[model samples]
Target: MTELIAATGSPSWDMSRTREMVRARWGDKALEALRPVLRAVTTRLIHARIHFQDYQRLVSEHLRQPLEAGTPWWELMWVDEEKGIGASNYFFIAAEGYVYAGVQAQHAIADNLAHVLYYSLGWNVDQRIPLGKVSLGTVCAQLARETTNSPELAPIQQALDALSTAPAYQALADVTNHIKHHGGLPVRVGWGTSEQTPFEVLLSAFSRKQQTQPPREIAAFLEETYDAMSRAVVTTGLALNEWLESSVAPAPPDNSLHQDSTPGGQELHPTDQPARV
Candidate 1:
């Protein structure tokens, strides 16, 4: 069974985890290596927080629904009338910002982490096509192949191996792909015939301006998926950090990463080091 309860005492935007991700990806002396990417990731996550706060404010202030802190909104129908129209109206109006922000926050988290993962493995992530264009599994497979039969890359290989099988990582990869590539996320909630979890809002539900409940199992699945993703990110980060620190060999150099490599291009000059955090 999944751990239904959330892990304790972590903020939604875990700065400590953020630091860990960067530090672990590069060793202590190489903070310079992670500077630019960290700044970019931090900026994105901070924007996510702003969106989340705005969303929560709207939901708390205008909606009549009796919501418990941290409760997934899909459970409201089970607690009261089957998909109350009044509640749905309040939800649609008040929770719009929350839904949008929620999705954006998830995207930012996935995006930043994906970059870190790419960089940690000694890839010239700066030269590759945007990672969002590629799938997580493909990234892992490519890394595994690059690291094959090399003892120095063993730790990196181990981390990659675990990520290939991790449930949380897989869930995150699936959801991120769906949100970024598909029309939109599909959520199910139980009511007369439907239900929803706090994080899920069915695109179809809103499109029809009505409710459709699936089953508690589906809601639970969504909840578990998000929960797993949260845990998986930290796990992947720690493994990455370990890999970066443990590898005895120097990271592979790529000419493409040189600030001056792209002649006349907009890349930062070689003298302009990425600033320290």
Candidate 2:
């Protein structure tokens, strides 16, 4: 059941057994402090999964709803019978929206993992830890520090390492960063024909430095990103579950909790106070 749950792209840390173990060792306060952060992580996973599935559905539907026989594929239009409006490339446009949404959520999950790992280490509040600005690389770097002394944390470090180092991970990050900081990448959505049959294709140049790079299939690119992100989430969750189960008896020290304070003289805890994202 644990394997199946993780395989389905749900966080492994949410398992009942893991929660029970955490509660037994860390006390109810730990669970209480972590509930919201875990929920936020799961929420982003839900968004990413929904967008991925929706984009796939749209791709399949677009293939089935091809232009009428002999009609030019370039003349892509959607007619609203009630409003008497014909919108151009509406289907692909909607699918593209899902693509962007899924990408955003997937990247956001990487950011959220920093919160998960931090809180899991028993730090309830610390102003030094950047909440929203934390990146996957940052998370991996923290994990490196933790695993140095506690070899038991090696699995967690490995899981995050695989995620941060994956080619698709960097590609997706480049695309998302480009979208956020620079401008949206040029995307081409239309119908194409091959020896087999006519099909819909959504293509984009993912290279941040080269706009003229040959366009790659958006569906395939997103599929790779989704798979990589899902695997990382599941693997991290499993590693965390193991950590929680094994390290439960001696609660880890809250290194950051007592050492830092917010500007208002309050301890920086994400549960008790909102951390700037």
User: Total clashing residue pairs per candidate?
Assistant: 14, 3
- lDDT of every model, 2 decimals: 0.44, 0.62
lDDT of 1 by residue, 103-161 (tens): 45545555455555665554543545354564455565666675666555555455545
Report residue 161 deviation for candidate 1 (angstroms). 5.9
Query: Once model 2 is optimally superposed onto the true structure by TM-score, how far is the C-alpha of residue 177 displaced, in angstroms?
Result: 1.1
For model 2, residues 144-220, the per-residue Cα lDDT tens digits are 88788989999988988998889888877887887788666555665456635465465565556764445667767
Query: TM per model?
Result: 0.48, 0.72
Identify the runs in model 2 with alpha carbons over 4 angstroms from their true place. Answer: 1-14, 57-63, 68-70, 77-86, 125-133, 195-197, 206-214, 250-277
Query: Where is model 1 more than 4 Å wrong at Cα?
Result: 1-33, 39-90, 93-96, 125-135, 151-226, 248-277
RMSD per candidate (Å) reads 12.2, 9.5
